[model samples]
Target: MMLLLTQQAYADDWGCQVMLCMSNPAGPMAVAECVPPMQRLYDAMSRKGFQWPTCDLAGKPDTPKPFKLDARPQVPGNLAPQTTGQ
Candidate 1:
């Protein structure tokens, strides 16, 4: 006998200044839940030193860019794909 496992996926989301960071963690959520989690993701990525399309949420570069979401894997510290986003 064989068993198959299906993967769960979250809705694609974009957050922060510009369409900078995107996330699809776990499964889908209500529209209200998107921003906070996405903000948390940006925080995590910032802590991990992701070196592109950054934003200073506390200060300038406050212009909101048109929202866009890309299905790209989160790559941090220029490490291998197998490495966690940390």
Candidate 2:
């Protein structure tokens, strides 16, 4: 069905972004754009009876496993930082 394909398309896009973001040597926190997609994936995984979405084009499904967000120290003058401070 068109609806299923549409959903799959969004999932693939989100999965690919998650893959690239998680792979960044600077870490996903350093990539501002990574948050939303990662959050979406995290939410889905957190739900009961979660199913892993197919992301063949994004590479191995086993990779980019959900990770805890690291706490970063707050810097003066910066109103906001991507990650919460310890």
Candidate 3:
């Protein structure tokens, strides 16, 4: 039973991926960076429970250079106020 539980824990591990665009010596470039299986992060922010294939960003990723990162609150998918609808 313990072995099965351990395996289930490992299966729940999630990846942290980010895209960074920067000014390389050659030119502007974008690269994907992943800091995976952030166990401590998982512990702190798993209040709503584990969500697969997605993360609630605690802090925005850094923009390397030559690219501007827009600081704005994203519109919640279905939470937006409807302009029209009886």
Cα TM-score of candidate 3 = 0.16
* lDDT (CA) per prediction: 0.49, 0.69, 0.38
Which candidate wins on TM-score?
Answer: 2
In the range 1-86, model 3's lDDT, one tens digit per residue, is 35543333232323323111122333222332222333344454666764444423424566333346655556777675545564
Clashes of each: 0, 0, 0
TM-score of predicted structure 1: 0.22
> Which has the greatest lDDT?
2
Worst 10 residues of 3 by lDDT: 15-24
Q: For candidate 1, lDDT tens digit of each residue in 1-86?
A: 99999854333323342233233334333345455655666676777666434444423567544446765677788765664676
What is the alpha-carbon lDDT of model 1 when measured against the actual structure?
0.49
Q: Name the candidate, 2 or 3, with the larger TM-score value.
A: 2
Superposed on all Cα atoms, model 1 deviates from the true structure by an RMSD in Å of 18.6
TM-score-based ranking: 2, 1, 3
Ranking by lDDT: 2, 1, 3
Candidate 2, residue 79: how far the Cα is off, in Å? 51
